[model samples]
Target: MNLPLHPLHLKEGGHVVDFHGFALPVRFSSILEESAAVRERSGLFDISHMGHFEIRGSDVVQAVNRLISSDLERVPSNKALYGHILTEEGGVVDDIMAYRFGEERVDLIVNASNRDIDRKWIEDRLPSGVRLADHSDGHVGMALQGPMSPRVIGKILPSLVDMGRREARTLSWKGGQFLVSRTGYTGEDGWELFGPSSEGFTLYSEILESGKAAGILLPAGLGARDLLRLEAGYPLYGQELTLDVTPFDARLDFAVSRSKGAFVGKEAILDASGKPIRHEGHPALTGFFVEGRGIPRTDCPIENGSGAVVGKVTSGGYSPRVGGGFGLGFVDPAFDREFRSGVSGKVRIHGQALPISFRPWPFVTGGILRAASV
Candidate 1:
């Protein structure tokens, strides 16, 4: 389960751990240290474990649009779109990023854990004239993120320096074309690089060398990646998203094409939107800032002032930007409504009802976002 860049990580002193069947780095130095480097400078991550599927043929756009919640028809060439593949019951099969090459080709990046299932799902639903090919094993994925990412990449791939957000381009490298997308999960100015697995070592080494020349690049791992995404208030597949959770529950309605025609789970999503379906009540994913000293963890109960259990934590951890323990959880719709209106609540951490406050999304935004920093 080693990635093509596995040797490079070990050489950089990365501590390896089993993550979704792949032996990936958990940390190179320290989570806090690596995360700080990414925010201030640059960090590179080995994301080759993710699934890569190439879908081609004249019906590529129409075929994928029928399977995902987002409308691929609206996406222009050389752009990337994020969407979810759902079941008929509105359960999420997987969250994916689709890179459109043109009208005839689209590349899908799916979760590592759900790779097999997602491939089968797409394969079974695709009609004639659409061809699906699994290139996961033959591809290498890396993400270079932070403020200095553009500078580092500019040194190696100068053509991508000016790529706009959510844009993708395939440039010739070593007689082969590699895909580079201006997208990332860390809520920073970043780019994702994907190319032949055989070239992974060379590509990673070149980026590392460029980063070292800039005097700022760090080799980050899953630990830093998790914390960074948490700080950005972004959701992980198995954590904030799951088969039991709908796009509505995770507050990812923007990914759904509401104006589009029929799609899988469209009816179910419409029915579940704003409806109380869960046991305690329908839930909405919300961010929390723990005022107390303890860090929040998964399954911890989120309670109201009246001592009623309203929700449970899905993903929780310490964030340097938040300056304290912060988490994302699904709370009862009623409780979420109250909190959005300025009512504070409590999260029970090991029997202690610590004071908790609502924190707006994209908890830390600056580098790429030109708006007011939160």
Candidate 2:
């Protein structure tokens, strides 16, 4: 696997790990330490391995709008949208964040592992007068996330302080152009920056220095990023979502706009909604809190009180901020109803049954999200 680290990452002593064919930093400090830093202050992340695509031409908006579940008509120019690209059968191809640059140009940020498939998917379905171009190789992306993100980022890009969530702007600095978006995977107020790949290190260093001067920034890695997002009740691709799961099944109906007229998966989505399919033989996906010491891993079986197999865990771990282990996974919706209503169940980890209970997500509350709005 090719290791693509931002120059500043090397300088900071990033410990790189192979993640789905891309070498990414597991942590600069320890995962727990980095996680604490973000909760208390801010953190920087190098996310250049993610993919980017440009869609342009006369009918770009109309063409692009038909491709995703979000109501793109409502997404104003210079604003970003969080939604999914669905297959013809209504299953999710990938969940992406699309930024509308203008009437004729739009930018898409997709998951790293799905880059090739997503590019080809958009290219094959492009309407007349619309063209799709892959620019992931030419751009490097990074995120500044946490409660203090806006304050630190404002030092470099003051205009960012007033930008609303999902807003974006193209700014110039040192003879280079960057498309900065007030968006991030973490449930914190932050921004995602995009610019030339060759200058990734220089830009990263400058941001790091600026953050250090502010005394609220820290270098975070994938570990902290995952936990923060999960705590926010955000769903991750390949875990809470998959090509086999429709947007409706994942409780993402908000993304599907029936008034948008015809999309690729319109028929399937409409039909499925009228008579949703229930996973009779499958376990339902739900949130659970572990009562004992055990970290649930992917494919960990979940059993009901009668010891019947109900579902399997998708993502799980001890949340440093939450002080307990929690997980998200699919189980039979029948079991889900029972569990949610107080029926007890157990998560099978290492061949041992660990007691579990259904818990509401966004386990932590009253943070920067409230303050940022104020």
lDDT of 1 by residue, 257-368 (tens): 8778778888878643434234234578998889889899999999988889999999899876778988999888888988877788989998999989988777777766
User: Which lDDT value does model 2 have at 135?
Assistant: 71
What are the runs in model 2 whose C-alpha is more than 4 Å off? 1-6, 272-283, 368-374
TM-score of each: 0.94, 0.93
Model 1 misplaced regions, further than 4 Å: 271-281, 369-374
The best candidate in terms of TM-score: 1
Clashes found in each candidate (C-alpha, N, C closer than 3 A)? 0, 10
Worst 10 residues of 1 by lDDT: 272-281
